[model samples]
Target: MFGYVIKRHQLWSGKVLLFPLSSSCASGASGVRFVFGRASAAGTERRTAPAESTGQGEAMYRRKMRGMYISKRALRKHFDPHNYPRETYLLCELQWRGSHKFWQHWLRNDDSKDCHAEKYFLEEIFEPRSYNICDMTWYLSWSPCGECCDIIQDFLEEQPNVNINIRVARLYYTDRASNRKGLRELASSPGVTLEIMDAEDYNYCWETFIQPGVYYRFSPENFESAIKRNCSQLDDILQGLHL
Candidate 1:
C-alpha cells in the first residue's frame, strides 16, 4: 500500500517477512530484509517514474485516494467474518522497468456486467513485459474472490517476469470452499505472496496514501486484536481447510 514490494521473498528467505504461515521462522536474504525497513513495507517509496495524473492512471492522489481510503470502522465492518460489502477495492503499487507506478480501482459496471478492479490493473493499466523484472504490492480491501483468484492465476502465469505481494484488509468469504481453495492455490503460486493486513499495514496505507506528512493516528481499542484475529484466519486459510 504505502511502502513496498518483495514478491514472496519470505518464500526465498526462511524469515516470516511480514506474516507467518507457520511457527518456523529464520532469516535469509539481506537485500530483501534491507528493503523492508519496517514491518511489511519498503523503507522508501520506489517512484522512479512519476504517477500519471490524467488519462487512465487515476492519479487523483489525495482526491481519489481519500475517496478510496478505507476507515478503521469500515475495516471492522467488512473485516468481520459475518459481514462484508459485495465489492472490492485495490490499492496497488508496481515497480516495472525501473519505474514505480501507483493506481487504484474498484469494480465497475459496464453494460450490467461487473468489471473487477484487478482486471483494470492487469488488462488496462499495465502492459505485459517479459524482459525486466516486475514487482507488485497490493493492498486489497477484500481478498481476491475465487473467480478473481483464477483470473490472477492466469495473469501471473502469463507474466512469468511478474511477482505479486498481496496484503488484504479482510478475508473474503473464507467460509465458502471455492474461495478458500482459490486463496490456498494463490498462496502456493510460485511468484505470489499473500498476507492479512496488520496494524503496521494499516498505518503504512494511511501514511503513504491518505495523509502523508500528518501525525500518525491512533487505532481503535479493538483494532489490534481484530488484526490478530484476521491474521489467524488468513494463516488458517493458507495452513488449514478451516477459516
Candidate 2:
C-alpha cells in the first residue's frame, strides 16, 4: 500500500484505483487517466484511467505531467550495467486509431502499490477503449517482466487491431532465463515490436516528455556503452523471433 488516496469511483473490477496520479489530474480532463485495479482474485477485470483533458487547462496540466520525468541526472544514474533502477516508467502515445483517452500519458510502477505502469495500460487504458485499428508507441524505462509479457500477449490476441512499438531503455532481468524467454515470446507476437532505446530515442524522450529548459542534457560520453550493451542483448532476445 503506497498510502495514496483513491479519488475516482471504481467503475471496473481490479485491485488499485488509478486516478489523480497527481491532484491536477482529478479534474478528469482529456489525457488524464482514471484507472482502477486489475481483475480481482475472483476473476474481476481491471480498468485503466483516461488522461485528464489536454484541452482547457493544457499548459498547467503539462507542467504537472512533465514534472514526473524527475531530472536529467536521475535518468543517467540507472543506465549503468552495475546500477539499474528498480522502478519502471512508461511514456506512451496512442495515435489516431481510436485510443482517444489514452492519447499521451506516462505511468510508473515505482509509485504504484502492486502494479507496474504496463498493468495500468493493459487493464485500464487499452482494455476499455480497444479499437479496430490501434497504433501506439511506447518508451519504457525498463523492459517488462515475464508476467506482463503474457498479459500483453493476451491483450494483443483479443484486440488483434492493437499494435505497439515498444522502445525500452534497458532490458529487465536479462540474467534470468524466464525473463529472456518471455521477451522472446513477446517479440514473436505479430503486433509488437521491441527494441532498445538508442541515444536518439533518449533525446526524443527528453525533448518531448521532460519539462522544457529545466534540465540540461548530459554529455555524449554518458550512457553510450550502456546503450550498445542493451542493444546487443535486445537483438539477441529477438534474433529469430521477428516476423
Candidate 3:
C-alpha cells in the first residue's frame, strides 16, 4: 500500500512524499528493516523552488494592486458578472420626407440609395455631446403645422444639450399645399431652440420657373431674405406667448 502526506513546514516540492507499507505488519517479528531514502540539500532546494517563485509572483501582484483603482462596486460587479450590457446610443429618424427620406434610410442603414445627396439637404441637429436630435424637414408643408411643436419638443428631449439649426432652401418656393404644411409644422414646434439658415438656392428653371404659371423664375437672394423675415415674426409670436 502507498500513501502520501504533507507537513505544514514542508516547502512546495515536499508535498509529494510517498510512504510504502508492506503487508507483513501482522506477523510477530522481533526485528524489522526500514530503508530511509536520504534527500540531498540540492534536491530539497529544487523541491522548494516552485513555492519560492509563486511567492515572488504573489508579491508582484500585490505591488501592482497599489497602482490599480478598483472601485468597491466595480469589484463586486465584476466578481458577480451581470447578464446585461450597457446601452451606448440612440437612433432618431422620425418625421422626414422627400429627399430627406433618403437620410432617414441612411440613418437606419448606410448602404441605402441616394446616399450622396447634397449636404444642404441633410442637416444633422446634434446635442452638445454629439447625439443626434432628429432630421429637420425643408418641405414642411407636407405635415400639418400643428404637429411641429410636439416634434420639436421630442427633438429637444433627444438632444437637450445642443442647439438646433434649421435648414431651408435659399430660393425655394413651395406650392399652396406644401406651404400650408410647412407653416403648420413650424407653428407646432415652438420649443425648437436653434439657428435657422437658408441654403444657397440652386437655380433650376424646370422647378422654380413654373411658379407664376407655366414658368416662374426665382431670385435666391429674395427667397432667403423672405424666410428670415418670417422666422423673425414667428420669434416675436413665441415671445408674446411667453414660450
My TM-score estimates for the predictions, one after another, are: 0.61, 0.66, 0.25
Candidate 1's C-alpha runs over 4 A off are 1-83, 97-112, 211-221
Error of 1 at 128 (Å): 2.0
Cα error of candidate 3 at position 150, Å:
1.5
The superposed Cα distance between candidate 1 and the true structure at residue 140, in angstroms, equals 0.6
lDDT of 2 by residue, 1-243 (tens): 133322332233334333444442222111223312221011111222342223211111122223334455655554333367777767776543322333345656635345766866676444333423546677787898888888888987787656788888888877777788889998788878888777777776566555567646555347789888888878877774332
Q: What TM-score does prediction 1 earn? A: 0.61
Q: Of the candidates numbered 2 and 3, which has the greater TM-score value?
A: 2
Off by over 4 Å in 2: 1-82, 98-102, 110-112, 127-131, 240-243
lDDT of each: 0.54, 0.57, 0.25
* Predicted structure 1: lDDT: 0.54
**Model 3, which residues run further than 4 Å from truth?**
1-144, 158-163, 168-218, 241-243
Per-residue error (Å), model 1, residue 179: 0.3
lDDT per residue (tens digit) for residues 1-243 in model 1: 211221222222333333322211111110111121222332122223433222222111121112444444444454343456765656565554443333332222122235566664576445555555556677777888888898888987887767788888778777898899889988888778888776667666555444234454455334666667888888888897574
